[model samples]
Target: MSINHTLKTQPVTPAHVQQEVKLAQRNLANSTPKENTTPEKGTDVKLSALTQHIKADSPRDIDMERVEKIKDAIRNGELKMDYDKIAQALLQNILDDR
Candidate 1:
């Protein structure tokens, strides 16, 4: 048994939608891709200077000489432990957290 029903046909796209599609295509066709250029030496220098500042903010570069000196001091028993100063700093940090 089959029930008869009329197939409804609606508009694929409204007039405004078709107009917007055309406008978007026109915009895309008119726009040009930006040209890529090789940076000059001055630009590279500026970028390098900017990177140096960024590196200074980050502790990525370790002072090997100073690190070795500290290691030697520790090995020679020349490194002194400041318990009071360390405790004071820790207490100050804890209080500052509040």
Candidate 2:
């Protein structure tokens, strides 16, 4: 199967170009500046509370000591994988999705 499409093009003259320029200038002259808005006091308070809660609940820095211990364990082949615990956790996650 094949499809054929045709496009129509307009020839631009000096008058056409001048008209476009005048239209653009008219639009610019008619444009107005938007008004600035301030949030209500209650909204500002709620936003600040949310920001503080987020900061408090999230970890700000990594525990370097714990990371080093895990790295050391891996290097010494002492890091053990508890397959049963992992499988149970995975299954619980799957069931929780329902």
Identify the candidate with maximal TM-score.
2
Query: Can you tell me which runs of candidate 2 are displaced by over 4 Å?
Result: 1-51, 56-61
Give the range of the ten consecutive residues with the poorest summed lDDT in model 1. Answer: 37-46
Per-residue lDDT of 7-98 in model 2, one digit per residue for the tens?
A: 77887679889999999998887786546957656643445776777677555467878999999999999999999999999999999999
Writing each residue's lDDT as its tens digit, candidate 1 over 1-98 gives 44686678986898899999999999997796657956666543445776778767555577888999999999999999999999999999999999
TM-score of each: 0.39, 0.44
- What lDDT does each candidate get? 0.85, 0.83
Let me know the TM-score candidate 1 reaches against the reference structure: 0.39
Candidate 2, position 4, lDDT: 72
